[model samples]
Every structure is written in structure tokens, then in C-alpha cells.
Target chain A: MEIVIVSLLNGLVYGMLLFMLASGLTLIFSMMGVLNFAHASVWMLGAYFAYEVSRFIGFLPALIIAPLLCAAVGAAIEVWGLRRVHHNGHVAELLFTFGLVFIIQRSVQMIWGMLPMPYRVPAALDFPLFTIYGANFPAYRGFMLFISALMLLAIWLMLKKTRIGLIIQGALTHPNMVSSLGHNVPLVFTTVFAGGCGLAGLAGVIGGNYLVTESSMADAMGPIVFVVVVFGGLGSLGGCFIASILMGMIQTFAVVIDASIGDVLKPIGIALSSETLLGEILTVPMARIGPLLPYLLMVFILLFRPRGLMGTRDT
Target chain B: MSTTLRAGAMPAPRSSLVGPIFRIFLIFALCMALPWLFYNYTTGRHSGFMLTMFSQMGMMAIFALSYNMLMGQAGLLSFGHAVFFGLGGYFCIHLLTAAGGGSLPVPLEILPLIAGLCSMLVAIVFGYMATRQRATAFAMITMGIGELVATAAVMFHAFFGGEGGVSSDRMIDRSLFGLTYSQGVQVYYLIVAWSFISILAMLYLTTTPLGRMANACRDNYERAQFMGYDPKFVRFIQFALSGLFAGIAGGLSAITYEIVTFDSVSGALSANALLMVFIGGTNAFGGPILGAVLITLMQSGVSLISNSWLVYVGVLFIGMVTFAPAGLAGLIAMHSPLQQAGRLKPLIVPYIRIVVPGLVTLIGFVGVVELLSFKTIGAAQGKKLVLFGNPIDATTAQPWLIVTGMFLLGGLWLWREGRWFHTLWEAMMADLKPKKGAAQ
Candidate 1:
């Protein structure tokens, strides 16, 4: 019971964080029709920025300032970098962002050194919030959850209630129409791009401390964020959220499930040794393949439902 | 010259092959003589480094060309191309090991072919799934497949050999022409021979009906569909054929290095292939060849100086994407119009003006990069900041002030001068309009 409850909570926390990152990517991808390959790197920059800002000021101020700075960088990238290559084609845009991943990651290294930064949870939120069967759940997690929930609410209110939000909604579903319908499409694109990057920054500020604030963190998170975006389907934030939580839960649960195909086959009187490829496949534990699940899910989704679960447009 | 006008098109078929065939032969001759040239003239002896670098350039050239088959011909932006290359290397090494153990009797000459076939096999399976979609969906699927294979390589130790990867001796029992594959020169020649064959084969493929159809699909998918060509089939075949060449490159890498690591199939290498293809200019056939060699030299040269060379590569890649989407080849090809109009000499003054400011801006950027990189890494290593053998203090405000000032001022000046250069270029181009009209 304790294992189940704790895993569930941990999975939720991870799911929320994944959603924060993936939501931005999905927004940019849906609106701009180019996968921002440097999205995760921007999130990394957010964490680095927060680290620097928090060092100079406090954690609260860093939390606000870092995301804004990320937004500004996102604006610059969209306006200066992406706009020039827009005429060249989508491939050029993707390559541009892909190159940015290397530049941003190395720049982070150049500034912060090769080692992980010492970004920590605030002292105010460092203590345990609750215990499930003697396992402590930190107060910092509650803080993370609150921030994510607040962002979600803000995103929902902005998209569904406000005028700019409605335009954003139109852009999400009927992007061509949004451009054709006398809207400031370029402005909308820049805003969406910046806002998405800001959300990723917020995730970084929170997740940097939750996980290890390392140089490699971007690479580790990049593919998974892609998996979430693709699996949830393009142009669907609801699907993005669903896919993230589902992936989070699956990963969280798979780590503890020690069963293999061999174990399943054992009851069927089909014993397999570790001599052959098939045997090895059968004998390998689920925990070992936990990291591969998102990719597998992404592949399966792309194969069966190219539009994704809740997508209106085909990716 | 006419081909340069249609820059973002398929490789131009030569009406008469006499000149091109002669050039091809000459290029191959150069490749064959390169090892000896380096051995006797420059180094006074065989330099393993030169041989290795040459061999690497050959393989990467093949890899980049294969990548261009998908990106340039089929319009498929695949992020997982190195899967074939890396897997091809792994298979070739295994083949080499088998030959060493007296089981496989195939000569070293045929191993690359076998590896290419093996790589094509994987490409066929993955291509089936990937080619099911086009554009972004296709790219995503490839990315997934690549990530899957990469993860599996680390997960299963059966074929991929886990983290330590697999290694084999290049000095296998069997050799061609009764000569043992012991010397670096021998291996280098073997790679060169294969590289020539692969290049010729790919060049021939560009003139084929399938290649033309692939280009047609790239330009207009619906039109190709109307013309009764299945776009997916074209992409699949192109992907597979490209995989064959990629695999052959991987085989060459295996023979040269005699070891394959998980890094071989990593996303980084995949990105490296993309960088090479794009930097060379995807439109022209020889573009990737230029990219492959330039990148190989840069990799060998720049890596010795700084661990942060990837940042430079990244910046270069992004810069190319933004400023020169057609690549270095494209920039050279762009000069054909000026040369044709006999107006090349007129733009010299404007070009010099732009070039001077560009150099200043570049130097400033380099200074900033050095200072920043030195502040972190150089200090960590307890090494003093040195530029052109002059000891410098990174902590000093003077260098920082000069670098920032130069960067900002030079950048502004360059922008203004660049606009003026563009105006002069336009005027030069306009001068051709009336001459062409009168000729018509």
C-alpha cells in the first residue's frame, strides 16, 4: 500500500513536470509547425538562470525572473533566428533549433562548468509535507505541484477566457485560418513561442532542484519530452497532459516490476535460457526497459494514430 | 553553369560524360596517391594520423551522400541515419572477428558490401514504418526508431555488446591480391576504393528514373501521386539504398578504427551527419563530399585545441541554416551568375568591404568565446588564458572591454556594410538583365 501510494504521488509529480515541459513544445509545434529541438535546452537554461538569479537574490525572485528571461530569449530566437530561415523551409527551422541545442548546452557548460549546479529547494519548502507509511513526501513537491497547477489554470484561463487566448486556441486548431483571418499572426507566433519557452523555464526552475541540475539533464529530458509531444499527438495540449501523466505512471511502475517474458512463459511450461537472442529478450527484466517505454509508446502512436490521441490535425 | 541556376534541384545529368568521367578518374587517382604523398613528401614517413583522417573523410563523405539521398532527393528529414552507419560498423567488426577466427572466408574488400547489405536490412524494417508517413511524422518515427535501437544497444549485450561495444582485428586472415591487410596504407586504399565505387554508384543512382521520381516527390508529393508514383515507396527505396551506402561507410570506419562504440549510433553522430550534409549543400552531388572532408579536418584539428569545439560546430550549423541554407557549396554555386555575366570583377570592392568587417566581427566573437571558455575550463585546469601563445588574464577588464566593444561595434558596422554590399550586388546583377534581354 505504501509503495503504491508513494509511487502514485511520485508519478503525479513527474507527470506534472513532464506536462510543463511538453506543453510548451506542443504549443510551439502546433502553432509554428516546427519542432523546437532546443526546447529542453531552453528549460536547462531556465534552471541555470534560476541558479544564478537565486544566488544573487532569493529563490522566489529567481522563480519569476528566470522564466521572463527565457521568454525574452525565446522571442529573440523566433524573431531573429527562426524568421530568417522560415522561407528556407521547415527542415531548416528544425536544424536551426537542433544546432541551438548544442550551442545552449555547451554555453551552459562554458558558464556553469561541466559539473551539476548546486540549485537546491528553498529552506522554507525543504521539510517533509506528509508521510505515507513512514515514507516522507517533501514539502518542495507540494510547492512544485502548486506552481504547475497555477500554470495550468493560467494557461486554461488565458486560452479559453481572454481575447488573445481565443486567438491562440484558433491557432492551435486552425492555424492556417488564424493567419488568414486578419490576426497579427507573427505577433501571435512570437507570443506563443515565448510563452511556451517561459513554461519550460518554470519547469526548469522547479525541476532543477527536484532532479540533478546537470548539463546532461537537457539531453536526458529532450527525447522524453518529444515522446510526450508525439504520443499526445500534435496540436493537442489535453492529449499532451494525458500522455505525460500516462508515461510518467508507466515509467514509475515499470521500474519496480521485476518480471520478464521468461517469468510469464515459465507458467506456460516454456523455459528459455539466456543463450540466444530470443532467450535474452525473454529473460530481460521490465525494469531495464523502463526508459524505452516512452519511445515504444511514441512509435506505436505514430504508427497506429498519426494524429495522436486527441489531435485534430495529422502530424 | 546552368545547373547553378536551379540550385535546389536534383543532381544535373551530364549530357557528355567525358569531362566528368576524367575528373572522377583524377579524383580517384588523388585518393589513391594521398597516402603516399603524405608518407613521403610531408611527414617523411607514414603518418597514421593522416591515414586515419583520410579514411574518416572517405567514410563520412559516403555517409553524408547517403544522408543527402533522403534529405535532398526524397525530402525526408531523418534524425536516425547514423543507426545504419553505426550498426553497419558493428556488423563489419563482427565479420572481421569471424574472419580472424577462421569461420568467415570473405576478403576485407567484400566486408563493406556485406555490412551495407546488413544495414539495408535494418533500414528496410525501419523504413517500412517510417515511410508510412511524410514530413514531420516521418522524422518523428525515425527519431523513435533511432532512440529505440540506441536504448536496445545498451540494453542487450547479445549483438550490440552493451556499453564496451565490440572490437575486432583488421588484420584478418584473408586479403585481396595476396597482400595482408596489416599496414595503414593498405586499409586506406581499401577504403578509398570502396569510397570511389560508392560515389560512382550514388552518382549513377541520381540519373536513374527512381532518383528523378524521388526528386519529383520531394518537390510535389500530390503531383507525384497523380503521376502514379507512390511517394512512400520512393522514400523507402531511397532510404534503403541510402542505408546501404551509410552501412558501407560504417564498415570502413570499423576497418579503420577496429572498434565500434555505442557513440557510433548515438544521436550526436546522427546530428553530425545532418551537419555535414547541410554544410556541404544538399542540392549538389559533390556538396556532401566537401562537407564531409571539411568537417573531418575540423574535427581532427579543432578538437585538439578546445573541448568546447562542438559549440563552434553548433554555432556554424545554426549560422548556415539561417544565412546559407544552401551551404558552402551553394554559396560557391551562387557565384556562377556573376561569372556568367562577366561581372565578377565589379563586386570585388564591395566584397572586400564586407569581408573586412566580417573578419573583425568573427575575431571579436572568437575573443568572447575564448574568454568565457577560459574563465570556466581554463581556470578549472589551472591553466592561464593564452591567445596566439600570449599569456592573458581572463579576470582583467581590458580584454573583456575590447572583445565586447569590438563585437558590438563591428557587428553594427558589418550590418550596415552588408546592406551596402547587397545593393552593389543587386546593381551588378541588374547590369546582366539588359545583356540577357538583348541576347534573347
Candidate 2:
């Protein structure tokens, strides 16, 4: 019962964080019709920025400032850089963002050097919030959950209630009609891009402290983010949310277990020696296969359900 | 926004001169002479540096050119082309190992071809599934498939051999021509020969009916369908054929290195192919060759000085896409009018103006890169970081100031001269065009 409860809470926290990162990427991908390969780089920058800010100021101020700076960077890149390549078509746009990935990664390395930043949680939030069956649930993780929840609510309110939000929604579903309605489509794009980067930054600020804030964090997170985006389907925030949570749970749960195909086959009277390929496959633990699950799910989704679970349109 | 021009409509037929028979002879000549040229003129048999580089170039040329067949002609963007190349290498190594054990009857020289064919077989399955979609969906599918395969390559030990990867003895079985294929130069020549034959075959493929239809489908699928061409079939065939060439490249790699690893099939290799194809200019048949050679040279040369070379490549790539959408081939094609009118000589002054600033910028950039990389990777390796026999500390203010100054000066000069160069280029081109009435 304790193991189950712990996994469930961890999964929720992990899922929420994935949602924060994937939501921004989904919005940008849906609106622009270009998968921003540099999205994870933006997340990495947020963490680096937060770390730098925290060194000079308090953690609270750093969190707010870092995300805003990321938004500004995103706006500048969209307005000045991506806009120029938009007319060249999709491949060119993808290539442009792909180029930005290298630049941003190297620039981060140059600025921060190659060492991992020690961005610790604030003392106030460092202690355990509670104990579940004698297992301590750290207060920092609880704070992360709260912050992500707040973000989710804020995004929901903005999307449903605000005028700009409504415009963004209309543009997302029907871009041609939004333009015909005299809306500044370019302005909408800039705003959406900024918002997406800001969200990615928020995830970075929170996750950087939660996880290891290393130079290779971006590369590690990049493929998973891409898997989420592709698995959730392009242009579907709801699908993105679902896919993020599912992936988070899959990864979290897969790590905790030690069962293998051999164990599953044991009851069926199928025994294998260590001499064969099948034996090797059967004996590998679930912990060892944790990294393979996301990719396997992604391939299965692309092959069987091209549109994804909650996706409204095909990518 | 500029109006979309429907440029690609129909594919051109085969070239009249240098038919398949002549091309085959040319390939043979080029291959046989390559090893002799490398051995006699340059460093002979000392770890086979020239031969190794040549073999690498040949393989990559095939890989990049094959990738272009999908991107340029078929209008399909694949992020997983390394899958075929890596698979080809793995199979070739496996075959070589089997032949060494006397389980297989194939000669070492023909093993690469077998690998290429095996890659084509895998391509048929992957291509059939992948060609079902178009555009973004197609790209996503390819990425997913690539990731799946890559993960499996690391996961399974039977075929992929896990992280340490698979290695085999290249000196396997009897030689086809009654000579032991044991030397670096011999293997290099074999790869070159196979590369030439593969490229010629690829070139021939583009002139066939299937290739023409691929162009037709790429330009307008609806129109192609109206003309009784199946775009799906066209894409499938092209994808398979491209895989075949990529596999040949892979086989050459396997034969040369005698090993294949997860890195061989990684996303980086796929990205490299994309970079090469785009840089070379996708439209021309020989464009990928130029891209492959330039990229390989840069990889060998520039990477020795800087770890941040990828950043420069990325920036150049983005700039290329935004400014010259058609690529280096397209840029060269743009100058054809001036060359045809014999007014190319007049533009030399303007070209030098631009080039001088460009050279300054490049020097500044490379210097900064070398300095930074020397501080990091070099320092970690415990190598003395020196410039002209003077040890320089990266933390020092002097080096920083010098780099900043060079960057500023070079950038300002280039910005000022680039516009003047552009205007002069236009004027020269206008002057070069023949009089309309006289031409008629």
C-alpha cells in the first residue's frame, strides 16, 4: 500500500512537471505548425537563468524573473529569427530552430561553464511536508506540485476567459478564419511563442532544483519532451496533457519495479538458460528497460493511432 | 509574401552522353587510381590517413546523396536515415565474421554489396509504413521509428550486440580477384569503387520513370494522380532505393572500421546527412557530393580546434535557410546568368570586397573557438594551451579583450562591405545579360 501510494504521488508530481514543459511546446507546435526543436533548450536556459538570479537575489524573485526573461528571449527569436524563415516553408523553419538548439546549448555552456549548478530548494520548502507510511514526502516536491497546479489554472483561465486567449484558441483551430476576422495573426504568434517559452522556463526553474542541474540536462530532457509532443499529438493541449502524465507515470513506475519477462514466464513453466537471446531479453529487469518505454510507446502510437489519444488533428 | 512558384513539374530524362557503360568504366578507373594516388604521392601506409579520409568521404558522399534523393526529389524529410546505414554496417560485419568462421562462402569484396541489398530489404518494410503519411506526420513517424530502433539496438544483444557494439575481422575468406585484400589502401579502393558504382546507379535511378514520377508527385500529388501515377508507390520505391545507397555507405564503413556501434545509427548521423544535403544544395545531383566533402573536411579540420564548431554550423545553417532557401547549389545556379553572358570577370572586384571581410570574420570566429576549446577539453586533457609557443591562460583579460576586438572590427567591416558587394554583384549580373534582340 505504501509503495503504491508513493508511486502515485511521485507520478502526479512528475506528470505535472511534464505537462508544464509539454503544454508550452504543444501550443507553439499547434499554432506555428513547426515543432520547435529548441523548446528543451529554452527549458535549460530557464534553469540556468534561475540559478544565476538566485545567486544574486532570493529564490522567489529568481523564479519570476527567469521565466519572464525566457519569454522575452522567445519573443525576440520569433519576431527576428523564426519570422524570416517562416516563408521558406516547414523544413526550413524546423532547420532554423534546430540550429538554435546548438547555439543555445553552447551559449549556456559558455555562460555557466560545464559544471552543474547547485540550485537548492529554499530552506522553508526543504523539509518534508508529510510522511506516508513512514516515507517522507519532501516539502520542495509538494511546492512544485502547488506551483504547477497554479500554472495550470492560470493557463486555463487565460485560455477560456481572456480576449487574447480566445483569439489564440480561434487561431489554433482555424488560422485562416482568425486572419479573415482582422486579428493580427503575427502578433498572436509572437504572444503564443513567448508564453510557451515562459512555461518551459517555469518548468526549468522548478525541475532544475528538483533534479540535477547539469549541462547535459537539456539533452536528457529533449527527446522525452519530443516524445510527449509527438505522442500527445500536435495542436492538442488536452492530448499533450494526457500524454505527459502517461509518460511520467510510465517512467516513474518502470524505475521502481524489478520484474522481468523471465518472472512472467516462470508461472507458465517456460524456463530459459543464460545462453540464448530470448533468455537475455527475459531476464533484463524492468528498471533496465525504463528508458525504452517512452520510445516504444511513441512508435506504437505513431503506428497504430497516428492522431494520438486526445488529438483533434493529425500531425 | 512572395508568390509560391510551382518550379518542379516534370523530371528530365537520362543524359545523352556518358551512358551507363561509359560511366561504369569511369568508376572503375577512378577507384583503381585512388589507392595508388594516396600511397605514392602522400603518406604511404602509416595508419592510412589519406585512404581512411577518402573512404569516409566516399561513404558519406553516398549517404548524403541518397538522403537528398528523399528530401530533394521526393519531398520527404527523414530524420532516421542512419537506421539503414547502421543496419548495413552491422550486417556486413556479421557477414565478415561468419566468413572468417568459414560459415559463409562470400568473398570480402562482395560483402558490402550484400549489405546494401539487405538494407534495401529492411527499407521496403520501413518505407511502406513511413510513406503512408506526408509532411509533418511523415517526419514524426520517421523520428519515432528511429528512436525505437536506436533503443532496441542498445537493448537487444543478439543482433545489435549492446553498448560495446559489434566488431569483426575484415580479413575474411578468399579475395575475389585472387589477391589478399589486407591493406588500408586496398580497402579504401574497394570502398571508392563501390561508392562510384552506387552513385552511378543512384544517378541512373533519377532518370528512370519511377524517378520522374517522384518529381511529379512531389510537385503536385493531385496532378500526378490525374496522370495515372501513384505518389505512394513513387515514394516507396525512392525510399527503398535511397536506403540501398545508404546501406552501401554503411557496408563500406563496416569494411573500413570493422565495427558498428549505436552511434552509427544515432540521430547525430541522421542530422549530419541533413546538414550535408542542405549545405550542398539539394536541387543538383552532384550537390550532396560537395556538401559531403566540405562537411567532412570541416569535421576533420575545424573540430580539431574547437568543440563549439557545431554552434557555428547551426548558425550557418539557419542563415542559409533564411537567406538562400535553395542552398549552395541554388546560390551557384543564380550566378549562371552572369557567367553565360561572360560578365563574370567584372564582378571579381566586388567578390573580393565581400570575401576579405568574410575571411576576417571567419578568422575571428575560429580564433575565439580555439581559445575557448583549448581552455576546456584541452585543459582537461592536461595539454599545455599555447599560441605561437606562448602559454595563454583563458582566465586572463588580455586574451578576452583581443578576441572581442577582432570580432567587433571584423563584424563592422563585413556589415559595411556586404551591402556594397551585393549592389555590385547585381550591377555586374545586369550588365552581363546579352541584348534581347541580338540574342534572338
Candidate 3:
């Protein structure tokens, strides 16, 4: 029970981080119909930027400044890079971002070398928040949860209550109509793209230290974020939120299960050895196959529910 | 928005002097002679580096062309195409092991074909699932499958051999030919022969009805469906066939390197295929061949000179995506009508003008990249920043200022020259348009 509670909290923290990245990607995909392959790279850039800023000025200022920088970078890419490639088609746009992945990764390496940064949780958030049985939940984890929830509320209110939110929502379904109504669709696009990237940046600000701030951080988090976006369903933030938590739970809980197919099958008179491939697969603990579960879930979801859990349109 | 022009619709230049068959043979001859061309008199043997590079080019050509079957011909963008390639190599290595142990009666030469068949089977199963969804969904599904297999490859120690990967000896003692396949040059020849066969086969496939239908589906999915063809089936078949060729390439790689690692099946390799096909030109049949050769050259040659070669590739790719969607082949194809109309002479001066500025800009850009890389990666590796036998201090601001000046000024010059060249080319093309209309 203690393990379950700790795992649940950990899962929630991870899920929220995943949501922070996936939300931006989902927004970009829904708006421009181009999957920004460099979304994680941008997140990585945010982390690096925050690391640099926090090294001198401190973390609080980094929380504000790094995201703004990411937003500026996003706006520039949308204007100079993506806007130019827009004429080629969505595939070209996607490829352009894909190319950016390589450039960003190499550029990061050139700037920072191949070592992981020493970005850490703030000293103020260094203490234990609470004790669940024997496991002490770190104050940093609570801070992460608090920030993510605040972000979630802010995004929801911005999309639901504000006048710009209404206009953005209007632009999503009827871009031509929105354009005709004297709204700058292109500007809206830039804003949305920048805003999404800012969200990713914010996630990186906290998640970098939460995880590891390495050169391979983007590569590690990239595909899993895509999986979340896909599994949650494109164009649906609610679905994305649900999928993120589900994926987080699965990832967290699977690592602690300690059981395998062999355990399940033993009651049915099936004894599996660890020699052959099939036998090994059956005998391997769930913890061992923890990394594989999300991909398996994604594939299965895609196979059965191509529209995803709550997708409005077929992908 | 600028009107998009499809490269396939461009007129083929009349080649009265050189027939297609002769061109193929000439290219084959060049490839066959490459090893000898780089031979060292002192060593009394062919250059191993040249042989390996050529062999890699051959295999990559097959891989890129196969990828083009989906991206170019069928308009299906795959992110997991390397899964087939990696699986094929893995199976081939296992087969080679069996052949080496004398249990498998199959000769080493036929191992690629067997590997290809194995890959085709895997593709059929995977493609059945993938082809169910078109466009973005298809891409996502393939990516998922790729991640799954790659993860599984690392997990399952049976087939993938874990991190150490699977290795095998090429000299299985079972051969159709009487030669012992122990030398690098011998493997190069084997690769060349297979590449020749595969390239011809792929080119032949482009003319077939299925290939034509694939093109039709890519251009107009609704119209193809109206023609009573199941677009799904066509995609599945194309996917499987491409996998077969990819597998063949993978098998050749296994033969060349004597090992297949998880890298072969990784997303990076799949991205390499995409890079090759896109950089080569998706619309032309010969585009991927050119792409494969150029990228392999860059991978082997440029990477040796600079640690940031991938950054150059990425920039080039982005440039291609932005300004030249038709790619190098498409750019070449654009000049065909001008050459045919005997109007190419006028553009020579403009071409030279652009080339000069282009080269200057390239040098400047390369200098900046090298300097930056040298400051970080090079400094860490304890390597001095050297340019043309001159050791430069990276800590100083002079080099940075010089390179940045060169980059900025050269870029401005290139941009100005490019506009002039574009206008001149457009005028020439406009002049030929009416004549072609009259001829039609």
C-alpha cells in the first residue's frame, strides 16, 4: 500500500511533465498540421538555457526568462524557417523540423560539450515535503506538482475565458473565417507556436533537474512525448492529459510490479524457461520490460483506435 | 503561396549521344574501377578505405532507393524503414553462422536473397498493420513499431545478441564461385554486383503497372480509389517490396562488415534513409542513387575532418526543404529543357556568378562551425584548431570576427547573385515555354 501511494504520486509528477511537453506538440499539430519533431529539442534548449541562467542569476528568474527565450526562438522559427517551408507541404515542414533536431543537438553539443549539466532542485525546495509510510516525498516533487497544476489551470483559463482564447479557438476550426474577420491568422499561428514552445520550456525548467540535464535528454523524452500525444488523441487537450497520466502510471507501476508472464502462467500449469526467446519474454519481469510497455500500448491503441481515445478526426 | 511544380512532370532531356543502357554500364564500370583507381603502389593492394567507402555507398544506394519506393513513388513517409534493414542483416548473420558451421547448405552468395525474403515476411506482417492508416497515422504507427523492435532488440538476447550485437565470418567455405571471399576488395565486388542488380530491378519496377498505380495513388488518392484500386493494398505491396530491397541492402552490409548491431535497426539509420532519399531527390528514379553516394562520401570523408559534420548535413537538409524541395536531382532536371533548346550557353555566366558566391558562403559557414566545434569538442579532445596547416587560437576574437564577417558578407553577395540568376533562368524558361506549347 505504501509502495502504491508513493508510486501514484511519482506517476502523477511524471504524467504532468509529459503533459507539459505533449500539450505543446498537440497544439502545434492541431494548428499547423505539422508535427514539430524538434519540440523536444526546444524543451532541451529551455533546460540548457535555464541551467545557464540559474548558474548566475538563480532559478526564480530562470523560470521566467528561459521560457521567454524559448518563446522568442519559437517565434523566429515560425517566421523564418517554418513559414518558408510552408509552401512545400506538411511533409516538408515536418522534415524541416526533423532537420532542426540534428542541428539543435549538434549545436548543443558544440556549445556545452558532451557532458550532462549540473542543474539541480532549488535549495528552498530541497527539504522533504511529507512522509508516506517510510518514503519521504521530496519538496521538489511537490513544487513540480504545484507548478504543473498551476500551468494546467492557466492554460485552461486562457483557452476558455479570454477573448484571444475565443479567437484562437475560432481560428482552429475556421481559419478562413477568422482571417476574414480581421484577425491576423498568421500572427495567431506565431503566438500559438510560441506559446506552445514556452510551455515546453517551462516544463524543462523544472523537469530538467527532476530528471537528468544531459545532451541525450531530448532524445530520451522525445518519442515518449509523441506516444503520449498520439495515444491521447490529436487536437484534444483533455485526452492528452488523460493519456499522459495513464502512460505515467504504467511506466511507474510497471517498474515496481516485479512479476512476469511466468508467474501468471504457472497457475495454469505452464512452466517457462529463460533460454529461448519466447521463454525469456515470458520469464522476464515486468520491471525489465517496463520501457517496452508504453510503445506496446501505443501500437495497440493505434491499431484499435486510430482516432485515439478522444480524437475528433481520423489521424 | 508560390505554385508548386512537380518534378516528375518535367521533360526528360534528349540524350542521343548516351543511351540509358550505356549510362548504366558506364556508371557500373566507374564503380568497378573505383578500388583500382585508389590503389597504393607501395602497399601492393587496393586502398581499404576506398573499398569500404564504395561498398557502403553501394549498400546505401539500395537502401535509399528502396526508401524512395515509399516516399517518392507511393507518398508514404516511413520512420521505421530501418527495422526491415536491420532484421535482414541480423538474419543474414545468423545464416552466415549456420553456413560457417556447415549445417546450412546455402552458399554465401544467396544469403542476401534469403535475408531479403525474411525481411519481406516481416514487412508483410508489419505493413498490414501500418497500411491500415494513411498519412500521419501511418508514420506514427511505423515509428511505434520501430521503437518496439529496437527496444526488443536490446532486451531479447536470442536474436539481436544484445549490445555486443551479432557477428559472423564471411568466409563460410560454401561458395558458388571458386574464390575465397576473404578480402575487402572481394566484398566490394560482391556489393557492386548486388547494387547493380538491385538498382536495375528498382528502375525496372518504376515502369511496371504496380509502380504506375502507386504513383497515381500518391498524386490522387481519391482518383485512384475511383479507378477501383485499393490504395491500402498498393501501399502494403510497395512497403513489402521496399522492405525486401532494404533487407537485401542490410544483408550486403552484414557481408561487408561481418557484423550487425542495434544501430542498423535504430531510428537514426531510418532517418539516414530519409536523408538520403530526400537529399537525392524523391521525384527522379536516379535521385536516391546520387543521394546515397553523396551522403556516404560526407559520412566517411567530411566526418573525418570535422566533428560537426552532422550539423552541416542538417543545415543542408533544411535548406533543401525550404528552397529546393525537388532536391539535387530535381534541380538538375530543371535544366533539361534549357539544354534541349540549346539555350544553356546564356546562363553559364550567371551560373558561374552564383557558384562563386555559393562557394564563398559555404567556406565561411564551414569556418564558423569548425571554430565553434573546436572551442568546445576540440578543446575537450585536446586537439588544436587547425585550418590549412595554420594553428589558430580559438580563445582569440580575431578568428571569430573574420569568419563571421566572411559569413555575413558572403551571404549577402550570394543572396544578390541568386536573385539575378533566378530572374535570368526564369526568363529563359519563359522563352522556352511558348515554343514547347507550339510544338505540342
Using lDDT, give the best candidate's number. 3
Native-to-model Cα distance after best TM-score fit, residue A21 in candidate 3, in Å: 0.7
Mind giving the per-residue lDDT tens digits that candidate 2 earns over B1-440? 01111233344554542675585577568756766664553544534666777778889999998999999989898989999999999989999999889999988888888998999999999898888877877787787778767877898888789998999988774788765667877777787778788877887877766777778788898898776666777788899989988998998899899889998898888889999999888898778887898888778766665566777887777778888878788889888877777767877887788888787777667667657766655666676666545677877879767766777898899989987877777776566555745688
TM-score of candidate 2 relative to the true fold: 0.93
Clashes of each: 0, 0, 0
Candidate 1 segments whose C-alpha is farther than 4 A from its true place: B1-18, B40-44
TM-score of 3: 0.97
Which model is ahead, 2 or 3, in terms of DockQ? 3
Whole-model lDDT per candidate:
0.89, 0.83, 0.90
Which docking class does model 3 fall in? Answer: high
The model with the greater lDDT, 2 or 3, is 3
Interface RMSD of each: 1.1, 2.5, 0.9
What TM-score goes with each of the models?
Answer: 0.96, 0.93, 0.97
- The two-chain DockQ for each candidate, comma-separated, is 0.79, 0.55, 0.85
| lDDT tens per residue, model 3, A87-184 | 88999999999999999999999898898999999899999999989899999999999999999999999999999989877766666788999988
lDDT of 2 at B172: 71
Instruction: Write candidate 1's Cα lDDT for B1-440 as tens digits.
Output: 22322333445566645565678889999888887766765546688888889989999999999999999878899989999999999999999999889898888889999999999999999999999899999899999988888888888887888999998888876877766878888888888989989998998888776788889989999997776667787888899999999999999999988999888898888888999999999998889999999888889977776667888888888889988889999999988987987778877888889999888888788788889988887789887777656777888899989888888899999999988887877787788788889999
Superposition error at B304 for model 3 (Å): 0.8
Candidate 3 chain B — worst ten consecutive residues by lDDT sum? B1-10
